[model samples]
Target chain A: MKKFINAVDNVLGESLDGFAAAHADLVTLGAERKFVRRRELNRSKVALISGGGSGHEPLHAGFVGHGMLDAACPGQVFTSPTPDQIVEAAQAVAGDAGVLFIVKNYAGDRMNFEMAAEIAEGRTATIVTDDDVAVEKSTYSIGRRGVAGTLIVEKIVGAAAEKGADLATCVALGERVNARTRSMGVALTSCTVPAAGTPTFALGEDEMEMGVGIHGEPGRRRVKLAQADAIASEMTTAIADDLAAPAGSEALLLVNGFGGTPTIELYLMYNAARRMLEQRGLRIARSLVGSYVTSLDMAGCSLTVSLLDAETTALWDAPVRTAALKW
Target chain B: MKKFINAVDNVLGESLDGFAAAHADLVTLGAERKFVRRRELNRSKVALISGGGSGHEPLHAGFVGHGMLDAACPGQVFTSPTPDQIVEAAQAVAGDAGVLFIVKNYAGDRMNFEMAAEIAEGRTATIVTDDDVAVEKSTYSIGRRGVAGTLIVEKIVGAAAEKGADLATCVALGERVNARTRSMGVALTSCTVPAAGTPTFALGEDEMEMGVGIHGEPGRRRVKLAQADAIASEMTTAIADDLAAPAGSEALLLVNGFGGTPTIELYLMYNAARRMLEQRGLRIARSLVGSYVTSLDMAGCSLTVSLLDAETTALWDAPVRTAALKW
Candidate 1:
């Protein structure tokens, strides 16, 4: 595969080094490259920490700042972080209000974050996200795999925490946000892991993988390539039906690209998805369209629908300062 | 070509609809979708206007908002906007302080923007950006083709305009910034325009186009794919040698992705480019790493370096709110 990489093992470390240096005003890298934490921690606020494999950039680490995550522990590409890394991160950022772990529902991630919570000091809690409506079980996850909805959870819940929510309040807000959110993705092409040096999967020229996972895992089924509106109809119908929010309910529509999709196409998908959601009687009150949670260099996009109440809407509108997100 | 688009003709219109919808708080689409203007225009400030082909998103339109362009016109994909679009945009946003058109150094773009200025009834000025150091002339232009450095020019000059710089001052600052900035790109794969329905160009499995243009035009040379450091060294040396800045000069380093490159690889490139610049004795006072300016779905990246003086540094740090960039 043609990629900008020095070596397979040094990918995460060197990327993190560059990330820290570029965003030096906002975040700091921990020793041994164990974690990325806010440059100035708020000692009175509850700490929100989240992380997973390295491919889904601007997720946990990019959201680390004033109104989002306190710290993030990144693992190798498509690999879960060790408990030691998590424990060290918690120790570094957990304040008087305590620490809350925002993790995707992958088996490896759940187990590792749980172990770290157990070993860490002070009050600690966990909010496991399983917002993907594609499948109830997958090869790497027992429940629905958390996808782009993870970003929504981090933003809303992190805003609440930034406003001085306690540990229990932060946990409740996070779990509620996760439950109210749903996401589904389609892959136009597979991504190549730097180490593997080949695409993770292969498809015919006119085929696509519907409801694909973030790590290039198998999706619901492979289907013929379709128009933007048709694809949007399928993904939006699935998410809206699964969400089952009342008609005319307010919602946030997010179109997330899987690394290789262009912003123009992402916005095009957003237009199609917004039309579909409006037809389904959901009011698009807030929207985010970009490549926030990516899957290496995969060429695809995911549509996330999050049911929003007044509190959540206000929280999402709250001011935030992060590397990838700010207002 | 696998892309999330409906019909080739509808690509720019539909994407602009979504962009306007997503950033309703910051911008508004003009009638007939000829231009994107700031939602709340500042009548007393010099209106910064820009336009070009559509594929390189977040360049003209995404930068239209507070502390940036007052309005931006978008043409068909890879085609320069018409004079009518530019004239209408000038009519919509030009105020007491008049209008300043920031045009890229392309034959089509320069001609169209010049025609619009002649017809536009206002105190209008022009800033033509020719920052590409790859070649003196390419397929699309008479001189160096403007690449990612246009973003830097918009940002710095837009900041000055926001702070009440007159038409002449804005033009002078923009031209100076353009002169100080230099950029070069490398493409691993060619982008497939929707209308063409095929790759714009081709490359062997182990080949790359160095100093490639944003439109996938031929670069300085096609060479065997090299390691990340080797590529970074060649690109950095070309820019630094051409810039010929003082050893201790302050500079801003921007590593921009060409749509299809992942954030991981972009940051890795940022790391490599940062090291090379430091070795050349330039103090990197500012850094921006992401896909701000892009070719449709090209898998590559471009590096941009702009010398920053005390005045430009503060302008760079000034608060601006746009769809793609905010701080």
Candidate 2:
């Protein structure tokens, strides 16, 4: 539960200032509080924008350059950015070619972004990403909670946008990536939010919760901490079965460490998933192992796989320039 | 520490298989033991090959893609990969262009990679990447420990190579990045290597060690847990003072969480560092806040900074395509 900051209220704004300072070439801050694209208005090219809460480091923001998003609006710690902020980011990054907002499936994100889209009615385009497969237990709950799988959607759609794909094409591509990708997570130790200054949830040392939401929401079930292979089997079975990416079909695997899981655990999970897929006759054409998207400092990891095609693979391999990610 | 894997012994091989599966367009694997470049060997470009222990997830391997390395050899768990494996990776990826070796500053990495380079001497070119700024206790000590700073060197040199900069230019650029970058780390809880199945070191809950090495080596000092802002101040002071980046000069800040620190903590630390730098009249031009490079599930983090010029900034912005890094 330890943290470093002068004041809890100023953390996000201060961090953004530091981010802008470090990535001046790729990003610039708008007085309106959005990260504006550094390249002068590429009116000829469609702009891509994505954003949400701040706990997921490098999710919407680290992806804001070159082959990915044109701009990103970071919210306060684990809180959605205001609709006004998103509207400002959308309008600022948009041009004659229009802008695409890649909103995650989360209710807060969806509602805020939808409101932003309304605010930008005449200014930009919007594309919602609903890639998470973990459904809510209650009918009153919002649809599936978007998790790390949204990243694959962002990358693909971002590439399409970079290639001068029209807003429609970009939106369609985003949808395709979402349909083909699925993610599920498990948490070992609940992380504490600095502002809240307490653990988000209570998790015993020997227990883990499966089907976790990115923002520390309760998962499908809590079970005894099992071996790496068992956990991988559990997460991967859910993903593979959902996508129906049977053996022989190529898939790209991403083992994401929730803020606190070590690379060692991620690798172990990756290995177990690979073995399980091999046994299932699935051929993994590529894999990403690390903290691509994270949930603050929660001690856990997630498995995300995007069933790939020639086009998806090409887009996935396309070059990109971002703060956390580089070839 | 909680981990994800079927078995300790199979972690490396399985993860490599998964990586190859996920990034087939960017990389290919040799029979059982080697990873090769997917880009048709541009005989004019120098092929850079690097590898060492497996725990440093993105280092040697995650960097292998356009604008960085040509191939990365994988070793078992935290142990060094064999010379034979490195030689094969080099031969498989090298063309008439020759190859470069980007080894860490560790004795194991240095000795193993050197032997591999020697083995491939007749057929390929090789260069060592020992960019870590942490110093050994004495010259009598084995070697300077390479840490996160090496990633900066890789990106710089890799971009140079992609731009058709030859071996000499790549080496010069690598060294420049090295000279401009410095990193120091601290650990809160000792990392428990899965293979070791126990904490790497002992520490009370309220204690931390600064100047900690990536591989869980004991640090220069162990002290009581300090506030996040205080920790960031201590780390940034060492890095800023070491580089002597003028108090008001533009600085690139990296608030890196060790394997287990939450994003909340990183953000808090980032806010502290930014304020501290600003108070000292330093201008943060850009900042990266996350776990770019990580140790095992060690509950701590490090701070890295590089004073950048136009060239460094350009390199930082160049597009890269790799498994761990994209865009």
Candidate 3:
């Protein structure tokens, strides 16, 4: 309840207004509300569009700019964006090259973005990512919940689109990247929704939840909080096993903070994960450790491993000028 | 206390290990134990060296790249780095032009950095920044405490050094930037130190501390938490009146989150501040909004405004490659 929001009901509109105001030079509000697009949208390039709930800041919106998503449709907290917002953003940024929709494998998100692509102008393709390795089902989705791997997919696919790849090419790359990546998360505490004015769920003072979803829903199970190294080992091993990456294979180990974790903690988690990977003979190629993905003030962290070859690695290192992921 | 650290005493070393490991492509651990330096050290340019307590991630180490600090020495959590660490960093990164030491206005930090500069090889200049407008003195600092403004000073001075400015020129520019910047902060909750294993202070559920320091020390006073607009108005007006920012002047707005605060709240605070600045007729020419500076797990935010002329704005806009701040 101590959040810095003006009102529970207006969190979405006001937060978006603040976002547009702060990043005026980089992005703008689409003709339709809840839609954010790059200010310097190029009508000739393949427009990349992706979005979901509102609590995960800098996800879709912060990723909008040169060499990234052309637009993002941010819904209310822990809610899927409406199709109208996506359709408007798609039409605004669509060109002769067409558009591609990047959807996380959530029922509402999949249905909404899919419907938007159906009605939107020009050719379109949808690549649904279900990267979470924690569980096969959650409260909001029948399949795995897409977590931090979506960011890696966005970066790789966004780079391809920037290089004048066609809509089909972008979709192929997104799916390829998604197949090579996996993510898992743990929650130390549940995040309270502003509208609810209370935690989404409750846990004992000494207890923690593993395999937690981004929306503060129940994870695999609630258990006693373990030491950092133990927690790190569990999460890292889960992600590494899920990838089944071959020996000597390189990867981009992404240690994403699930909002509310400090940078110091994220770095410590990185250390624990690195030790595990090194011992397993998996070549630690590149790494990004920070809160790139989050679950609104939830005190926990997640790990994602994107197996990288020369092509994907090059795209990952390609110059990107977005508010969040920039190299 | 809930944190991601492996051990209380090992927090500094393990985190530094992870930082070096994660950004090995751009930085390396100086032969000395805790010093972090750019991998591409240029011998012909003036070297910018900074360090302090370890909790503030993405400050000194994350800024060690193309257009920022050449090296940084991180101490144990919430403690000033030793003189040996700073001296080693200064010696390692020193170029033909010599080294410039950027010191925050904390007793331990100032003394250690000053001592290091005295012993380090080659010419050395120390510029202490005291831009915290919250108070003239604090528990740890004799004069003003250097808060988020230190990030601005480093960015501006580092850019000046990259353009081959002399050591004196870089020092003068850093001091000028410091003089033109001011900051203030508010905390809704206290941060618990990993070693201490307890919150620094306690407040009622509805209370907040204004003009709080980054270390979670006592501020001016505690009062009931206000709405986002009222809080923003108080903090923004305090900084604006302190700077005496001209009605038509252009300035860079830095909205920083203190580790645990969510991005939505930071944006809400940003929106409120933007309105106040526009009412005062100050143009926000540039803004770097994110959790660039932080206190571990503290639920609060701080604002830094740097009054920029044409020259400073260009320097601020200059391209710099680092793990945290870029472009």
Query: Which candidate number has the best lDDT?
Result: 1
Judge candidate 3 at residue B62 and give its lDDT.
92
iRMSD of prediction 1: 0.6
Residue B183, candidate 1: C-alpha displacement in angstroms:
0.4
DockQ of each two-chain model: 0.83, 0.40, 0.73
Give the poorly placed runs of model 3, Cα more than 4 Å off: A137-141, B137-141
Residue by residue across A1-327, what tens digits does model 1's lDDT show?
A: 989988888988889999999999999999999999999988789988898988998777999999999999999998889899999998899877889999998989999998998899989999989888898545543778888999999999889999988889989999899999999999999999998989999988899999998998867899999999999999999999899999999999999999999999999999999999999999999999999999999999999999999999999999999999897
lDDT of 2 by residue, B1-327 (tens): 466655667666766766665556777777775554555555568887777777766566767788888878877756777889888777676666677787776778788887877777544444444434446436636645667777777777888888888777777777777777777788888877767877888988678887887777778899888866777778877776667776667667777766787655675577677777777766877666666567767777777777778888888768877755556
Chain B TM-score of candidate number 1: 0.98
Docking class of 1: high
lDDT digits (tens) for residues A1-327 of candidate 3: 788878898777877888898888889997536599999978888889999987887787889999989999998898999989898888788899988889888888999998887788788889888899888545544878888899999999999899988888888899999999988898988898899999889888788999987888879888888888999888878878778877899988999887788888888889889889878778889899988778888889898888999999999989898888777
* Distance from true location, Cα of B123 in model 1, Å: 1.6
Give a tens-digit lDDT track for model 1, residues B1-327.
Answer: 999999988999999999999999999999999999999988889999999999998778999999889999999998899999999998898888999999988899999999998999978999999999997645644888888999999999999999999999999999999999999999988998889999988889899999887876767799999888888999999999999999999999999999999999999999999999999999999999999999999999999999999999999999999998899
The lowest-lDDT stretch of 10 consecutive residues in candidate 1 chain B is B135-144
lDDT values, one for every candidate: 0.92, 0.74, 0.86
Q: What interface RMSD do all candidates show, one decimal each?
A: 0.6, 3.2, 1.1
Instruction: Name the lDDT value of residue B18 in candidate 3.
Output: 88
